[model samples]
Target: MKLHAADILVIFWLGFLTVSTVKGSVASQIAPRSSCVDLSTQQLDIRNLAKYEMQHIPVKAVMFITRRGIKICVQPDLKWVQNAIKFLDKRPVTRRPTTKPKSKPKPKPKGN
Candidate 1:
């Protein structure tokens, strides 16, 4: 393969951009650390098991931790799940509020 200075520069630039973008995406995905609600145990549970995924249950006092690879029920984090529910409840539901129409200004008369 013929090596060229321009080719190396282009590859380096592309790799830098890709890394930066991935970092930004991962940062955005992970919610900022806040005292709002604690879920330390839940997070550990998510990372430890190879085949497991957590799902928040709003109404019920339990969080589903189903196995991923084999797809089976593992265990429910009732207490932590409840805390998650509380956290979700505290979050504000953003919706555009309806408002009445405002009167428009009158048009000025044009000179003949």
Candidate 2:
């Protein structure tokens, strides 16, 4: 089999195109959906908040996830929001015990 410069270039171009197409699709799938249409200004209890995620589409806002599984969209520039984030960051993390406790064995009954 004879090798040519044009043939090598064609193979390289095809490989690049395949990689680019796959990368674009994967990126779209990995990006989170934009769910915030309205931003809330109401004050939220820091104790109820579990975590937060920053959203860019539709509007730039902070999505706060409460411990009760509620999602609240708030303006990122709000003073309370910023303070809440700082408080959450400094709060201690509580984790559930992973292992089960050992069970006590029952005493054997006396033989008749």
lDDT of each structure?
0.49, 0.90
Q: Write candidate 1's Cα lDDT for 30-105 as tens digits.
A: 6532111223333324332333234343222233233353232323455544454455556566668989799899
Could you give me the TM-score of model 1 versus the true structure? 0.29
Candidate 1 versus truth, CA RMSD in Å, comes to 14.0
In candidate 2, which residue pairs get closer than 3 Å at backbone N, Cα or C atoms, i.e. clash?
Answer: none
Point to the candidate with the largest TM-score. Answer: 2
lDDT of 2 by residue, 18-94 (tens): 99999989888866564787999899999899988888888999999999889999999999999998998888888
- Which predicted model would earn the best lDDT? 2
Q: Which residue ranges in model 1 land beyond 4 Å of their true spot?
A: 30-112
Error of 1 at 108 (Å): 57
Measure candidate 2: CA RMSD. 6.7
